[model samples]
Target: MTMQIRFEMPSDEALLLKDMAERFVADHYSLAQRSRMLAAPATELPAHWPRMADLGWLGAALPEACGGLGLSPQQVLPLIEVLGAGLVLEPVTPATLQCATVIARLLPEDRASDVLAPILAGQQIEVLVAGPDGMEPAVSARPVPGGWELSGTVRLVPGGAAAAAFWVAVDIDGAAVLRVPAAEAEVTAYRLLDGQAAASVCFDGVLCPPDACWTGARAALDAGAEMALFGALAETSGLVAALLRATLDHVKLREQFGRPIGRFQTVQHRLADMYICREEVRSMVQLAAEAMAGEASDKRRRLLSAAKVKTGDCARAVVRDAIQFHGGMGMTDELAVGHMVKRLLVLGQAGGTRAGHLTAFSAAS
Candidate 1:
């Protein structure tokens, strides 16, 4: 008996958005531009953030009532994949998707419109500061006269330096979330190895009104983490795919033994292995996205962790092989592969490490 392997096709809208993202990246986002942005002073988002808002990409996963497209997470994966391939340095996952989801889902109805409107309009940037592995809250909150006072430090917040506001996870009796204006905290910003900016924010007696605090923050944080993981997986899949393409192109042009290196059986096998890894990661990403859209919370958490582990392992493998195939040029700044390898390394550590996710998956089981 013969078995067939099937791949799910994206929806028509997703296909359209994917094409738009590709064209946008090809026209506006390039390796040279990425390099320039990385070298620039860290502030909030790129100037193209407004353009992304104009294209409706910022609100792709938000509800229509909140000025978003009301699309599911699966529909937004294609755009994320394209952004990843371009190595765009925007904080789509940690800021737009994750923070937006938390605000939309957990914030009070009256406050949602106030927060989500500006964000969806690209007038504000917000970064989520949740603890890793769902452990203890990184920040703590105490009740004050009119509201809550937050005190603690949140480390390694993606895009935190440039954010206009922060969604901080705090323990006030239990897990709670607070929206603290960036001006209220001390932000120590630095760039990651991949040229992305992050920060350590210290909230020293920052006062937030009662309306700024949201209850049931644990569930919201879990959901936000899952969403962020899905976005990261999509981006990593794109990065792996781009690496494979670059490696193939390099092998085809670079001569070894008076012929293209790609003609060698050993080189061909290595390229094939890289391709297989990319495909596996891509499939797992899609599965996780689908689960996030439909599955129950417990099931979604398990699937997201499973996807993160698989994606991280495959990403490391693919990046390592791609670098090896590129010879000495792979590690140089002149080539994009070296930069991609750096991004993959960061992604592996983001959200949760592979070993950590595997442990989470096991515990869940």
Candidate 2:
């Protein structure tokens, strides 16, 4: 039999989480609320953040031993997709899955708990500025009398303004990670194109105790990167689906020649193309999920890179076509399509540029 790729049916737990997330979005995360949040300072956490924690969202992906639910990657993918459809503002996956994975699996048990507890409770955040940038991991570090002195500037770190600590990758004989508290760095806070909180963090001879460093964190870094890739792909796929649905509804209601545009042959063709784009992305997300389930290897990296690259192209295609179908209304800031398009624009380039990921894919191959 020929091979087939499809979205696996979500587990009961994932279905439960997905329903909860949809309910949460419907009950609280309205388009109006999103607009208001966009108008506010990006550094101020959204009002619904604590509620996400209270609903067990923050601890959903972490292991019970690490103060998390320890759900599998597939089990959590639907929740991310649903949140993406709603355009939820919180960095739930990164703060919960990616950041927590690094902190819990790499740091000392006691220290990890200390850092992760507040994060899981929505009381604090920690971020890595180099997320999805695919840059050469760089944070200059040297042994000092009392500890290590680090010097480097990481720019445009998402969530950095509110982060309590930063997981900065350093080259010490090999790849390593330093858990530096946000207080130790000079952070210049700003907002991204998609209205996410961001900052440029600089370390000038910042001292760190030996206990704060995790040597040979290349594995930890790889694991974190995998989770980040999975979350981005899944979330963007959700956005693609939502945009497709919105565009479909618009076409059916829009009129041309005294008839619904969706009934016309041209609009029908466009909608079909958009639907195909959506399905392509959905398939790639499934591939990402499967790749994440396996071991961290060159093959896994290559597959994730391919999915990332494909997801970027398809997200843009759907958004561009959706805009075209909306007759310029999609471009208006007041519309959800406008905001979704902007977010997709950011996601399309933020994690890994097409060229960057292309190079990565080539190397992996």
Candidate 3:
């Protein structure tokens, strides 16, 4: 009875979105642009932020009334590939996929707009800090007379440096999920290896009002977290594609011996293996996306965990082989290959490590 999803074709809307995204990447993004952004990765704001909002990408997952396409995680999944391939650093996974999803799904219609509207308009950047398992243990929240007080610091918040606010949660006995304004916490900004701005936020007894807590959403945190995990998996799929393309081009060129190195049997075998890995990742990603979009079940959880493991292992192996094929240039920032590898490394560990995801897969099975 498990794994009954039929192989379906992409809908018109999904195809159109992919076409539009391809055009956007062609027109707006480049390796040189990524280099400039990489230099200033401590700030989450990108020059194309407004453009992404204008295209409704930031709100792509929210409901139609909320100025979005009401796209499910599976429907909007193609956009993640585009962002990853272009090396765009706009926090799509954190803001669009995670926080925006939680706000739209959990908050009342009236209140959801307050957070989602600004994000859709590119006026505010909100992110989630819920850990791999429900809530991060580093943060502690205790009930108070007026509301609640939160202490401790979370060392890593992807895209948190420029986050206008954070949808934070603590692993405690109650509905601890709530929004905290950036000013209320001390945010030390920095850059991730992937050139995305990040922060370590220290919340010293930050007071959270009763209205701020998402008590009803406490139980559904896992769903939101899974959506983000699926996004990472999708992005890594895109990165694998990029690495394959880059490696192919390099092999075709850069002559060695008397002819191109690509003519060598050993190089050809590696290329064939990389292509197979890419196809495997593509198939696994689709299955995982389908499973995640279905009703909540142990089957869905196991599929997602399997996907994380597959994508993570494949990304590492292929990227390593790609660097070897590219010679020394593969590790240099001058080439897109190296940057894509770095992103693959970071995203490969987005939800969980290979061993960790394997454990999850086993538990779910």
What is the C-alpha lDDT profile of model 1 across 264-309, one tens digit per residue? 9999998998989999998889888778777777777787889998
Residue 348 accuracy (lDDT) in model 2: 77
Cα lDDT listed for each candidate:
0.82, 0.80, 0.81
TM-score of 1: 0.94
Give TM-scores for every candidate, taking all chains together and pairing residue i with residue i. Answer: 0.94, 0.93, 0.95
RMSD of each: 3.2, 2.6, 1.8
Model 1, total clashes: 2
Best-fitting candidate, measured by lDDT? 1
lDDT per residue for candidate 3 within 1-365, as digits (tens), equals 45546647777887788788899988777887667766764655767778899988888777887678888667777888878888888888888887787777778787888768888998878888766543444577888998879988888888898999988876546545778999899999988887878899998889988788877566456666777888888889988998999899999997989899999999999999999999999888888888876746678878888888888878888999989999988778788888889889888767766787798888776
Deviating ranges (above 4 Å) for candidate 3: 1-4, 133-137
Candidate 3: worst 10 consecutive residues by lDDT? Answer: 129-138
lDDT of 1: 0.82
lDDT of 2 by residue, 1-365 (tens): 22233546888988999999999989877889877776776667666778888888888877777777888777888898999888887877666667778777787677777778888888877875444543246579899988789988877676676677888878777878878998888988787777667788898879989888778887777777777778888889999999999999999998879998899888899889889989999888887786677545676778788988999988988988899999878778777898788878877776777887789899877
